[model samples]
Target chain A: MKQDGLTIPGLLVASLVGLILVAALLDGRGAHATPGEERLFLPDAKYLKPMLIGFHGVAADLLWIRTVQYVGTHVETDRKFPQLAKALNLATSLDPHFLEPYRFGGLYLLYLARQPQAAVSLLEKGAAANPGRWELPHDLGRYYYLEAHDYARSREWWERAATLPGRPDYLPRFVARLYAETDHRETALELWSEIYRTAQNDSVRSLALQEIERLKAGSSEGPLGL
Target chain B: MTVAAIALNTFREAVRDRILYAILIFALVMLAGSTILVTISVGGEVKIIKDLGLACISIFGTLIAIFLGIGLVSKEIERRTLYTIITKPIHRYQFILGKYLGLVLTLLVNVAVMALGLLGLAYLWEGVSSVRLFLAVLFIFLELMLVTALALLFSAFSSPTLSAIFTLSLFVAGHLSGDLRLFAARFGGAVTKLSAETLYFLLPNLSRLNFKDQAVHGFGVDGGSMGLSFLYAIFHIAALVLAAMAIFERRDFK
Candidate 1:
């Protein structure tokens, strides 16, 4: 009887210790990796599509927010943005009409990731998906002119944007100036300044500031010298 | 009079169900939570709220419909209460229709509460509400009505658990039926294509009823399509309910 009593308490103590040890091990494993590590493995949009059960828009919103957070977290590190494009792709694919991810994700790809081709592809996809929205084409024009220096393509995109309703008043002026091929540096400076002022976050603002400084230094060197 | 009495009784019984209230509370919380969620977004805050809110109503309303609906006939039969109702002068079809209507009425009330919460939140955030949002809600209600009909149909012949599974699978399949046709056209062999095409035509094309995208983006849904979608939903519900009645009529109490 005494042995049985002792065995029960002993078994209870052993179970408690085992649970504590298991929890500690799990917590330690979780703490070893950054939280962002877990989000690195996002499933393809095709797999998630059926599971969303018509909540694709909400899924897009949440994924876009996750992309934003991922960028903010990794922007100060290697600035690799390894999953940024994929996250944005998934979000946009889930709801093709969602415009913010396309525009902002394009910018992030262009400036942060230094993948202008990827950025152009994303903006082009956005343009194709949302022909009525002028912003995608407008952003494409800015990207080609500012990042790629593809003046001809930039001019074409700006002209397209000019025809779209709700495009900014300045797009026509930009298109006409592009036709003239005059004051590229000044135009870039003005665009970057506008971006700096309207930037939503510190990282985007700092990126715009860097471009503004580069444009200013280039102008100081000489006309078309740098 | 008999159908009305059974419907009213079913409605009274369903309204008192804690599961209905629980699902409603979760939905309302999610709708309210969308406001908090929008604070983190840079732009399209109103769009985010509307999308999330509308999704919450549709998803939770469907859950309520399925959970309550699956139990409607089965619980009656399980408790032997259905024996009394069947032995009455009323037909079995009346009981099934009454139960279906009762659950749909419950869903209507719950969906209305969620929709109001969403509209109130959207107005608070954006200071404007569109008629398209309400149109989206109407389509969502139609979707829920069909889902309730599906649950009623499955519950007429199967256990509650199996009925819930069947209803849930049909709900998923309904949404994906459009994609199934696309897949058939793209990748399916002749036999597979024929089968996929047949299933696609037979299954409800729920994507046709989705107006959340247009509603969120402030696009107008054409009148003809809206009328067609409504008619489609009504026809599907009528077909499913009629099938359920046919099954229930043939069921033997002995």
Candidate 2:
């Protein structure tokens, strides 16, 4: 039998089915309750702490997103940092090995949230679990130097970061400058330049390079010129 | 016995198709490429890998299910091989079931290889094997099985082009049935609600089979939930196959 041409009714039926399917898939709301919010507790709360610690990585991811979302735009204030710190503490405590909440939670708590103390605490947890990783300690040093402005603490953390395997070559110089003091600004600019040049990821390199340029433009006649 | 032979032959034929290999290779490359992409991600690198891996598995696996499954019976008919097979003592349902099973075997092998690759890559990154990942992959296989049934059902009564379109549409609807019910109840009028309900029942509800998000995050498997999902897939496949058998049994090929 010869195949019949495309019939109008057949086309309409197909169109209706297509429309129905599209309408179905376009609805993307998740389940009503957030996964791990109910289980949050402090380490001092021993009975509740045990339950909180057992929550899984997916719950940790959700809590991390929710915690950041909850912290909102007032992120730079000390008030916002504590709330975020509390949530991240809960999240990472639940799933200690989850890499994202550690990196992102620490960045938000330290840099954006302006709680360098809390950031240090969180990154310390990450470092303890993920021993030998250079990034976590490097972040710890960044928080101390840039946010806390404690040169001594910054030098200590940077020294630790430098000793870690897989650390960049210029980290040792940065750690040395923290103690030498004489050429610290010039060394920071140089270190940032190396960060830009040798960074593995483009975005990270871009951010580092931008910061170096900003520093240079600010202190044109300063150590940046040398 | 003849039906088993035909099914085995078709399975071998599908395995050898260059299109199948092309899709398989592409999916593997993307799954592995996710590792390199993870390094660039500022944070949530592991989540990114799992997200991309799971999405690739579903999309590529669905393509394999629909393309091969839609053509299984129609290709036989088109090539006039169905006439020879139909003239034998074998029943039409056996032929249909055998063809469906053959495609399913192909999908199982493809899904297993992809799942193992995803699991291995994830373990390499995390340094721990996730039992949840394997369970999530099993759910993906069940999802594909529902789609294979849909394709076979459509092919029983329609042209290959129509069969492919209908089956793909069914796959999409099944993925979103829960959301569709919500939309209908909340905003749609009476007619829309009824139509949505009808579709909800007629199409396989594949969203029920998705434990990927939960599993990917290393949340332990909910055994009861997985059992329910398996039952749902099996029931859907049974209904579709029965419908196809009924249609094929009545059709006059003379």
Candidate 3:
């Protein structure tokens, strides 16, 4: 420790001292300048790159975990997540493998954030990366089926998702039900009721409940005097 | 003959080591404690349980491998037991291979216990069982075998402290190797790039063994990829154990 030309600790300390001296010099130089009122959050891109990568991954993971939790809380309270859409997007953007960000995150964005376009874009990206994954397609189908009420489009998405690897055997049944929703609203209601009961996350359950109520209300209105 | 006998003897010796009990108890406790941990997670408590359970298994499994592995050969030599064993009827490779297999067997039993704890926690939290969770843990257990083999190789030639440190560094680097190469490509200098590239190929590339993420989301893990990874880890372990045997065979007890 005493005789080495530059031990690892000494080298690290010397570098720290040099950095402090330079920072002090920069501060001294900036002292003469007038303080400007105008300011934008334009951080130094060079330094920010590493920082962004570090924070983005951490934030993305944090947000994903929180979003999953929020899904449950939202369902229990029957609340819309109009604010969580961007956070969810930010998470998925940072970590594309985060499949839930596309499925349930899109759900929040569509129903809660009231951003169907963003939801569509999120699902599309998820579907592309995870083509063999069923969750994204199922959620995409949900967006069209319940939120958009475009049965034809919903059926298309569901059918495609149901064909993916590892999809539940019940997926085709759900697809068939989607097509029959117009004639059999009650069946849809019952299915959604089952989904709501079995739902792991609260937000999804709340969404299912909303759909059930809508279906019940619609059925009672007696099928638009066809 | 002496090498095989020593390795089997060491295996029997290590099974009686108290450190194994201490580590296994801690691991099982943590796995059991995951039930409480799950409640703190936001809404996806099952996901939380799985995450914590898998993490506990990996961490404790690595600890057992490292702690026991580092001493497997070094302790025998330190106690002057290797001199007796080495001058007798066994081959050096048999000793190394036997010791490795024995430690691996210990790891299997320990992992099974921890996995049972995980499965129990999952059952309690979600009221459902995941065969996939067990399969994921199985892969992780296999990965730890590679770590144990590497640790033993280092122990054969180095002091226990150095072996432990080297093995731990390898563990961290192995897990982060993919990310390291990506970072190097993006921003590293010439020397950093060369070293990163060299280490990429030289190391075991344990990230391939990671299916925890897939398990967490209930995503479909590629069976082909998993099979390839298992083979890679096995081959790597065999090569390390053989190298350790080569080193042990040449070293003079005097």
Per-residue error at B112 for model 2, in Å? 1.6
Please provide, for model 1 over B41-97, each residue's C-alpha lDDT reduced to its tens digit, 9 standing for 90 to 100. 766788899999998998898899899989988999889998887778988888888
- Residue-level lDDT of model 2, residues A36-103, one tens digit each, is 23333334322333332122444555565566445542432223444577777777766666666666
| Docking outcome class, model 3 | incorrect
Candidate 3, A185-206: lDDT as tens digits? 6545655776687665665687
What TM-score would every model get versus the actual structure?
0.89, 0.58, 0.65
Show where candidate 3 strays beyond 4 Å: A1-65, A68-83, A86-103, A110-118, A132-135, A145-195, A201-226, B1-4, B36-51, B77-98, B119-135, B178-198, B211-228, B250-254
Per lDDT, the best of the predicted structures is 1
lDDT of 1 at A179: 85
Q: RMSD of model 3, in Å? A: 11.2
By TM-score rank, best first, the candidates go: 1, 3, 2
- i-RMSD values for every candidate model: 1.4, 9.4, 6.1
lDDT of 3 by residue, B164-188 (tens): 9999888877766777789889999
**Tens-digit lDDT string for candidate 1 (A104-193):** 898888778877778888888889999998999889998878766788999999899889999888888888898888988888888888
Steric clash pairs (candidate 3): A71-A203, A72-A202, A75-A202, A75-A203, B1-B89, B1-B90, B1-B91, B2-B89, B2-B90, B3-B90
